[model samples]
Target: MPPTPPEPAAVLARPHTAELTGWGRTAPTASDVRRPTSATELQRALPNGSPRGLLARGLGRGYGDCAQNSGGTVVETTDVDAFTIHDADPASDTVLVTAEAGASIDRLLHALVPQGLFVPVTPGTRYVTVGGAIAADIHGKNHHRKGSWCQHVTSLHLQLADGEVVEIGPDRDPELFWATAGGMGLTGVVLDATFACPRIGSSRLLVDTDRAADLDEVLELMASGDHAYDYSVAWIDLMAGGRATGRSVLTRGRFATAEEAAPAAGPDPYAYSAGVLASAPPFVPDGLLNKLTVRAFNELWFRKAPVRRRDELQTIPTFFHPLDMVGGWNRIYGPQGFLQWQFVIPFGAEATLRRIIEELSASGCTSFLAVLKAFGEADPAPLSFPAPGWTLALDIPAGVRGLGPLLDRLDELVVAEGGRVYLAKDSRVRPELVPQMYPRLDEWRAVRNRVDPQRRIRSDLSRRLGL
Candidate 1:
């Protein structure tokens, strides 16, 4: 589908009411959506402790219910999208920009890439908003090198439950700031943020691609050589069995310098384009992606990757957000939707990782999207998801038989090994395991209590997990 046309100003000014669902499309809820055009308007729309609570929703990129508040007020921040870029600091070689929470990363990229700059951290897709990035403390392929998105953020204005906007940062008000980072917007609504961006020579990346034979080889390859690249990730094939299980295509990259890219640069050495190339059909049958079909697709995909390719040039979209090209791709899973299960196990828990992949392969649940990456240090946010470990994420048809028990069992194994699932991508995790997964839950709750004393800011995720 083509993008929705911009609404007329008068019509845009009116409040919106709609049924909302997260990116996963598994859970849907009715909400009164308040599209505030400015920070002042956002503050005015504050719930004042509504019984159903309120949530600040961004571009709706969170895979789960973190952005949805059932039967409550949802403050959609996309209208407050405006940003101003500043000159780079010569000493630090970093440029700073203050962007309203509603601005999508795609918007920022369009403005920055041509100027030879890029966001310090990006998740798999660039469709998320600045506030959504900070809220999730999102990580990327370079997590082993630069860490999560919140680390680059300098300061932000957060509107508390009482509509009082406060400036907070790592040093100024570290407690509240960190609490809000990865806190899933429970503390307050983020209005705007000033973050540091790294300078880039071109909008292309010099990437190296390698095919790993199996689970063991892929793990060894990433652990031994990932330090050489600024970004690294592996597409693992969980359907492969026995000796070929976990066979993967590992791709690692560093930004291509202007000199290296000029040969094919045409007029603009830093030209960038990330427009969607295609859209998935509006509807698909639930059983279209069964184990047999997935296995065949996996085989084809695996075979298509080069066994060893070095320093190949690729655009930012191709390297970082290939999925963005296919709009509404999630609908391919059919009306039943799909569940994205993402979890991180500590560095020493490689055996657990192998076991999980093994179990999933045996489960017969179809999953074409599965990736493995190495995570470095965790951000100081009490609720930050990443840690020094290996994080794996995959999508599975929600209607898979015995899927519940299968994931439930995996949760115990993860907790036993001191790991936790990513809340942003979760849909069906049990509430009781939350504390075990996030040990600093109480510390975060304390800060949340001070900011939202009446618990005015609540999301379906918070209510579900009792955050």
Candidate 2:
């Protein structure tokens, strides 16, 4: 049985704690945080009245302010962790799994993969929570072949802003269902969800790697080869110039069958570390990752990953999330941290991409990690960010002068080319441009207002963008 809810007054006056965005590191602020271990406690902590204000926070993996609230209450959902394998249909080759929103995808996969099952979708990092993944409608390398995470979700147990706990799915409250998928927690707090899991043969990924001479070559490879693999992604050397400008290394992979699988030799599957469990030191020297250092790193990475080859016996973590193994890795960007800029431009806007890449090169703002991927069909969610196009993601340190203005210019270019930024990783998109990027903004707002008439659902991002 779950524990009883805590009294609302008991949580008042409690110290506010900020998240790991590192934004608060240089200038710290606080919020009244509630870490409820059960749904009863969750209900008790919600604000009272017609529109109860609250925000949900997972692992704090969101790059910007999406998971944060300034003065309002924040419900830390990490305590609601639980996972149950409902059924495994051997004949149908599908697995039905139910997990509390707080369960981390990495932890869940460690357990599922050994049993020959895998989540249908996963972001670049497995550290994200199931609830966070759904709220953001995250897309993986396989997005070209599969849709966003919402496409696999069978049902969601949500706690509405008004304190009503409801079960919503395709068959029930379909509008609320789609809205909550990419809703960014504006609709309600996700309690738990059930989704379909794909069957896997082994823990290894059969990978095919190749190098592209430029952005155009990268796109051509993806367009021609994406269907042959379950997962595909390209790492761009943003600093490369002239004929080698936008040079990239593309990797495509699929689950290895028993006949192709190698022997496992590592820590027991269930005992793997939770990942980067510690934060970076309070202060880091500035200019630690400036142009010179970044350019050198880019050269090494591109040269190391040869032109074309096949690599066998690849571990799951090395293939899907190489960054997770390094603890306190964000510190590499120094104390100011970094901003991940990810935007997608439609297929016909090749010229727009060329212009954006040219600007980055001219400015010498070489992103250490620049990834390019192709997006397939668009999701139905009003706020979903993916579509049939090419998406580029770059991690830029925040301390650079004129960085904000450059981003604003890029935003203009994106808007002009019919592109949109990912809200989960954004902190600076203009409010007016948001409606333009998301045509269904008003529709989502209507659904949100209907559920929380007083506009209780709020967050730093929501308040900043007027969502």
- Among all candidates shown, the one with the greatest lDDT: 1
Name the regions of candidate 2 deviating beyond 4 angstroms.
1-29, 48-52, 263-282
Compute the lDDT of residue 82 as modeled in candidate 2: 88
After the best TM-score superposition of candidate 1, give how far the Cα of residue 34 lies from its true spot, in angstroms: 1.4
- Candidate 2 lDDT over 1-467, as tens digits, reads 89988875565334345443422222223455777787566666665411325788898888888887766677777877888998655787778888998899987887888787888988888888989998999999889888889888889898887788889987789899889988998898888999988888777778899999898898889888898888999999888878887899999998877667645524332222335545656567978888898999888888898689885557778888888876556777776777888999999898899889888877777478598998989878999999899899988887778888898999999998889999998877788899988889999988898887877778878887988
Instruction: Please report, in order, the local distance difference test score of every candidate based on alpha carbons.
Output: 0.90, 0.81
TM-score of each: 0.97, 0.92
Residue pairs clashing, model 1: none
lDDT of 2: 0.81
After superposition, candidate 1 runs with Cα above 4 Å error: 1-12, 47-49
lDDT of 1 at 360: 88
Error of 2 at 412 (Å): 1.3
